[model samples]
Target: MERDSQLELYQAVAVRLKEAHARVRSLQVPEGVRMALSRKLLAITAVAKHDLARAARRLDRLMKDLDEGRFPEGD
Candidate 1:
């Protein structure tokens, strides 16, 4: 596949990941589980957010590399 097409796909995935992260941030925990499991849930959510952020950063770097003609050959 061509580099431009791969870059577009990366951009699309990054956008979707960002949107999903926003949705996750906007979610409310149900009242039933809020008292007992809230901390655990929040911790898990934090980890997920961190991972998503890392992925987004990597995607941004990839896009930049592609634009600058710095992408490694045979990638």
Candidate 2:
């Protein structure tokens, strides 16, 4: 509920996402399926990475605003 807690939650999620992304990148598919499915898998991972990045940026902005004493309009 508070800004500090919210910021910590966002940072924890971002860290987990990054770890998952790295694990996915390091996965090795069987040679037979790798040729057929690699591209699609890579695309999916790319989208996940992009979404995670966007979320991190938004969280960073929110934290900055909180630090500057600029509370959201409604709260």
Candidate 3:
């Protein structure tokens, strides 16, 4: 991808990341579960810094899991 398009994808990823964090924080799950979800989002954010496209795909799957109520089990 060109630099310009990569920049655009990064911007979109940032927005989605922010939304995902908020969604995870707002979840009614237990603290452990919330923390696990938050950790996954953080991992995605870190991945975004290196591979925006891969990060975006991971983020999309995370969002889908959240939407479908497929949360991680609490410890």
TM-scores for candidates 1 onward, in order: 0.38, 0.39, 0.95
Candidate models: Cα lDDT each: 0.47, 0.49, 0.92
Models ranked on TM-score? 3, 2, 1
Report clash pairs, candidate 3. none
Each candidate's clash count: 0, 0, 0
Best by TM-score: 3
TM-score of 2: 0.39
Stretches of candidate 3 exceeding 4 Å from the true structure: none
- What is candidate 3's local distance difference test score? 0.92
Candidate 1 — which residues are off by over 4 angstroms?
Answer: 30-75
Ten contiguous residues with the weakest lDDT in model 2: 33-42
Off by over 4 Å in 2: 30-75
- Greater lDDT among 2 and 3 belongs to 3
Q: Report the error of model 1 at residue 26, Å.
A: 0.4
Superior by lDDT: candidate 1 or candidate 3: 3
